[model samples]
Target: MEALGWFLFAYQVFVLYYFAVLNFLYTTFTFFGLNMVARYARELSELSLKDLLEREAYLPVSILVPTYNEEKTIAASVRSFLALRYPEFEVIVVADGPKDRTLEVLKEAFALVEVDWVYRRALPTKPIRAVYRSLAHPNLLVVDKENGGKADALNAGLNFARYPLFCAVDADSLLDPEALLRASRLFLEDERVLAVGGTIRPLNGARVRGGVVEELRLPRGFLEKMQIIEYARAFFLGRAGWSAMDALLIISGAFGIFRREEALRVGGYRTDTVGEDMELVVRLHRKAREAGRDYRVLYTPDPICYTEVPSDWATLRRQRNRWHRGLWEVLLAHRAMLFNPRYGRLGFVALPYFLFFEALGPVVEVLGYALL
Candidate 1:
């Protein structure tokens, strides 16, 4: 009994140490994130943005939206993309064989007509059924493809993307007018930046008209309203900190831009995992570091993409489960990088953080509760 008591006391000390280290790291990140965000905001002012446009330095971008059973939100989302302030961009909506009326609604809303599009398949994806061109918006193209997951749909879109840069977005989300311009500017300013992640806000309470969010408001549901706060904290602090350090491992799947050639060189999104976004980003970091190439993956708060949050408990639970599982999968897949000097900060610091604090957070929480 005495030995067991000593063991318990030691375990308690370890837990306390773990908790302190985690909070200290979070605090440091928060400070770094705030500074980075402030700098980004100043650089993204109206004059700077206008000058960027006038200089014609921005690269053309292809927006790849993967749709699945999204009949209600598909049209509005596409319209929002159409109204972005970027100089040159094409909206490619890949309908991932939805069981709902997603295809029909897109066709009717955009006056889509089947077109003969011939392009090289740079990446292997599920078979595509047909391609459509919209009469209403010349820049919009819709591809009806076989039933594939989000990553697969993105792969299909990647196969036909013509631009040098590609932005991946969810079909149910709405982007701010300047979202693309803000996100794409990083790539233009620095040749080393391979990818940039943008901020995503909850769209549950926003008023939408003509594909634009007219007003930003708190969501009606308690859960969704809480999520808004959670998202703000994560993006404003967590991602910003990582970006400032140039060790950001994950760019969100909801909205992020990537250099086309770099993404293709890394084999696009991995279709096998739920955490494809993080996996792709990690692979990018690994590949770049392994090649001895000077490169950066960034995150900025200026680009805002609003997406609807799951209000009900069941849906939210499933979402959280998927996220946790994905985090574990990514960490396991890249376990070789942990504590390795070769990957620098990514291996020595970031990977370990995700492995312990994030991947095993739930277990720690459970243990703490049980101890109490």
Candidate 2:
């Protein structure tokens, strides 16, 4: 009984230390992130944007949308992409054999016409049934393919992408007009920049017109309101914080731009993992480190993408569950980068932070609740 009591005491102490350390690290990151934001805003100005526009110092981009059963939002989302303010870009929407009227909706909405063209199969993916191009929008192209997961669909889109850079956008999300313009600038400014992740805001209760969030209003759902708070902390705080250290891991799948060559060199997205976005980022880090290359996967606060958050209990639970599992999958996959000095800050600082705090923190919290 005494030994059991001592063990319980130790566990309680550990939990206390865990929370303390976690909060302290987050606080430090908050300050670093704030400094980064201030410096970035001061350094980058409208004149720079105008200079890029005039000099054409921008890399042309291909926007890849990997979707399944997103029929309701596909049309509007495409409209928003077509309206983006960028010099040169194409929107490639890959329909991964949706069971709904996603294909039909896209066909009618975009006036999609089937055409045949040979392309390089840079990565293996499920078969592509047909390719459609919109007569109305020359830049809009749709790939109808067999049911593959989101990652596989992205790989398929990568195969069809024609630009040196590609931006991955979720079918249900809408980007700010200057999103591509702002994000693509990073690639042009720095050759070492591999990927740039944009901020994603919850779109519930926001008025929409032509796929743009016209007005912001608080939603009636309690969960939605809470998610707004959570999203803010996760992105603005956690992401920005890690980014300041050059250790930002996850560039959300909802919206992230990547250099096409580097992604293909890394073999594109891993289809088996649900956490494809995070895994790809980690892998990119690993590859860059191994090759002794100076590379950056960045998170910028400006370019924003608005997405729908789950409104109900069941959906929210499922999403959280998936995210938790995906985090585990990524950590396990890159176990080599956990603490090895070769990975530098990524191994010693970033990966350990994720393993101890983000991934295992919840498990410890739950166990603490049960024991106490």
Candidate 3:
């Protein structure tokens, strides 16, 4: 009985220590993030962003939309992409074998016609059924393909992507008119930038006109309001902090731009994992570090993508499950980079921080709650 009491006391002490450490690290990150956000704000204010747009200095991008059963939002999302303020861009929508009428709706809405275009299969993916070019929008292309999954669909779109730069976005998302211009400018400014992640805002209760979000408003759902606050904290602070240290690991799959050549070189998206976005970003970091290349994967707060957040408990639970699973998968898969000095800040700091605090955080939280 005495030994058990001693053991329980030790466990309690450990939990307290863990709780304090975890919160301290997060608070540190929050401070760093706020500083970075302020720096970005100043940079944007001083920089002549319009000069890049007017002079057409931004790189061309192929926007890849991997859709499963998004019949309702596919057309509007494509319209949003088409209306982007960038000088040169193309929208590639991949219908990943939806049982619903996603393909038919896209065809009817956009006047899509079959087109034979040659593409290099740099990465293997599910077979493409047909490629369609929209008569109504010249910059729009659609791919009908087998049901592989999000990663597989993105691979198919990658194969069909024509430009050197490509942006991956969720089908149920909408980008700001200058989103491409803002994200692509990072690539132009820095030769070493391999990927750029944009901020994502919830799209509920916003006044959208012609596929563009004209006015922002708070959603009626309590869950969505909670998420809006969460997003503001994560993107504005956490992501900016990571970017400041050049240790950003995860770029939200909802909106991110990558160099096609670097992504292809790394064998494209790994289809086995649901956290394909983070997996790809981590892989890029690993490859660049191993190759002794001076490279950066960045997160910018200006380029915004609006996505619908889960408004109910069940949907939110599923989303959180997938996220945690993905985090574990990426952490385990690249365990070699955990603390090796060779990978610099990534292996020494970022990888360890994620593994200890983020990945194992839930376990610690549960232990603390139970003990309390």
How does each model score on TM-score? 0.98, 0.98, 0.97
Better of 2 and 3 by TM-score: 2
Poorest 10 consecutive residues by lDDT, candidate 3: 45-54
Instruction: Sort the candidates on lDDT, descending order.
Output: 1, 2, 3
Model 2 Cα lDDT, one tens digit per residue, 79-140: 99999989999999999989999999999999999999688999999999999999999999
All candidates' lDDT scores?
0.93, 0.92, 0.91
- Cα-based lDDT at residue 215, candidate 2: 91
Model 2's TM-score against the true structure: 0.98
Global local distance difference test of model 3: 0.91
Q: What TM-score would candidate 3 get against the native?
A: 0.97
What does candidate 3 score in Cα RMSD to the true structure?
Answer: 1.4
**lDDT of candidate 2 at residue 200, scale 0 to 100:** 91
Question: What is the alpha-carbon lDDT of model 2 when measured against the actual structure?
Answer: 0.92
> What lDDT tens digits, residue by residue, belong to model 3 across residues 116-157?
989988889888889999998899999999999999999999
Which prediction has more favorable lDDT, 1 or 3? 1
Error of 3 at 116 (Å): 1.6
